[model samples]
Target: MSDTHLLICGNSFNDVDRDRLSTAYPAVYVDAPADMAALESGLRASMRAVAFKGHTPFGAEAMDLFPQLGLIANYGVGYDAIDVGAASARGIAVTNTPDVLSDDVADLAVALMITQARTMIRGHAHVASGRWATEGEIPLNRKVSGSTVGIVGLGRIGREIADRLAAFKMDIHYTSRSEKETPGWTYHNDVVSLAGAVDFLVVALVGGPDTKGQVSREAIAALGPRGVVVNISRGSTIDEGALLDALEAGNIAGAALDVFENEPNPDPRFLKLSNVVLQPHQGSGTVETRTAMAELQLANVAAFLEGRDLLTQVN
Candidate 1:
């Protein structure tokens, strides 16, 4: 057996991938864990860098169990669920597939804008529930063209969204950590002011402790009654309760969400509202994107085994 033992705390590994792992390391796969305790037990017994599927979190305590863990190759781009600082403290490198998912996520963001703006959900519910005739012609939803679009956290995905929206003749404005010098776009130093400035506030920021509650109640309120909020980023970036309250009060026009704080199990309260559009974190769920993500993850693992630097190290 190879000295580099590998363990995966996630869904079924690709059969080909599993067979490949068997060639080099003692690969283990666990599914539908009852609790973290079971996962902890598995990690403690393993002496290798562990891979996690979905949103399995590897915090300080979890990291402590694997002394020989050289790296954590997370399955997704966002490391919100993982404790990067904790992993670094233990001299473990954390890698995420970032650029691979940016365009996919940006596509979802624009799709959200189109879906919510066109009231696609309202029309769909009408037809599905057999109430289309009774509803008597679905009302017109908001328009996307030539609208002021404000992007929060103007990173790779945000920039992509901006580029796509420009084709619609929409005015672009953004708020980031610092002012970016992109030509033909307005930059706002204050997110609250930026929220108030645009017809649609599109969120494409990363989610983690730092970005937790970044979109505050005050910011949401600033968006005004006619403003639409679109979140293609992590849900933790927005205050869920505050968002619900804004939707209830009609403070903001509507929202299109592709991700949530409690994913796979989003707040049930959001489902009750017709003004909100929800997607099950499928921003990067495309076959092409997912395959790319897995390939990158495998490359990261292979590089580590060869004593090479990670392709997309989070640190």
Candidate 2:
């Protein structure tokens, strides 16, 4: 039997990094978690680690396939798709690439807020479609600078977003599990209060059941008309249905979303909205950030294989 100790899964990894992984270890590449069953015939029974990279549900059943598996190194910072409890029960360690992608994600969050506020997409379309000459000047858009902004979940990435927005001379309001030492910034005990206090609401919360739909209908309603929402965090962190309803009813002015409930193929409703700006969840898609994430994932896998301390171990 081949000593293929590493199984690389998920379609997010690029060709260069895939080649690097194969060259570094006796690795078998599975395109995605869903294809694991079909490729089971070719998988080495001695596989000890998995380099996971997608948002597929990898549970105890999948873990059972590799009796000797010891680690699941996630490519992204969010590992809610993986069953951490199941991994722990099987004596498997989990690690994710965090902090490295924080700045890039934060940058995108700020970009989305600005893009939505200024109606940049519409302005670009107006110029490209020759509507600028035919229809005269584009309509005035909202200003982002000096506006009051609310940040949901002030963790590592959240803090980065707040710091960048602060440079825009905006008032920062945030709601986290605990108050952070943010001088001059307002901290709300709840999301609704934070939403009501700001012109823009940016979601920076983590994923999982606890935070799923953390931005509820009440929060969206509290934002009210003229308020813009920017989300760069996981799709589940926001109540997509409430957001859609608000957009349709003009309860909220606009939204700039990088993540969605159905990513790469979000709701068709979002397509028709003129006030919304959509992104294909590319917050950390830059080459520099992606390369760092890949390196961190591989480092964790290598540590597990070499019986060294796992870098960024989750459980």
Candidate 3:
């Protein structure tokens, strides 16, 4: 029997990525955190590292199951699903694949902003469904170029998004822990002010307790019915209830979301709206970025197993 030192948790891994990890280490695979408890005592004891890849909560209880777990190598940039405090308390290191996916996520955010602003989906449908030929012409939508955009977080991904929009001649405004050194870009101390100042608000804040609902009802209201929101970050960073309310009542212009509070099955109310642009959480879904993420995750797993320094250790 192969050694079970590495356990691959979560069902989101593609076949190639799974094969790469399993080939690199003696591994066991489980679909979710709950399945870890079903393994035999000896096997659980053998798990030294976990390559986690899903949004499922891997908390203290789940960590306790693997008594020998030394590392939790999360697959994506956001390690919000894993309980870092619990892992730290248990002497387990945590690593995440961050910068590799930043460009892809940033690209998606920009694409979403442009798509919603210009109504690309509707335009495509108009041509594909023969509506343009029959009805004469589709309505002209808003232009993205030369518009004002506010980025909620000036992190790696956030900066990338701002840089892309800046190329389009946009006036960039951002809010972060502290002001960055970028010249000409306005810095807001609060999200409400940021939303009020820009035509498009992009959320790139990290997901965690500190940031949950950081974009509140007041912030959404401050957008003043002319602003659009583009979120490529985790669903927890924004107040989904407030965003939905704004969309439904036309309090804000619309939203282009790559993440949601309840994913795979978002709120049914979103289905009824035509202004919103919804995505299936595919921020880093490109083949190149995902392959890079998997490689980073595997590198972290190997580093932990071989007693080397972790590449992107968070805790």
Query: Who wins the lDDT comparison?
Result: 3
Runs in model 3 with CA error above 4 Å? none
lDDT, ranked from best to worst? 3, 2, 1
Candidate 1 similarity to native, TM-score: 0.90
Q: Could you say which candidate leads in TM-score?
A: 3
After superposition, which runs of candidate 1 have C-alpha atoms over 4 Å from their true positions?
1-4, 12-25, 31-46, 125-136
Residue pairs of candidate 2 with colliding backbone atoms? none
TM-score ranking of the models: 3, 2, 1
Candidate 3, position 85, lDDT: 100
- lDDT by candidate, in order shown: 0.82, 0.91, 0.93
Model 2, span 89-194: residue lDDT tens: 9999999999999999999999898888888998999999999999999888888889999999999999999999999999999999999888999999999999
Error of 2 at 3 (Å): 2.0
Q: How good is model 2 by TM-score?
A: 0.96
TM agreement with the true structure for every prediction: 0.90, 0.96, 0.98
Worst 10 residues of 1 by lDDT: 32-41
Q: Which residue pairs in candidate 3 have backbone atoms (N, alpha carbon, C) closer than 3 angstroms, thus clashing? A: none
What lDDT score is found at residue 14 in candidate 1?
63
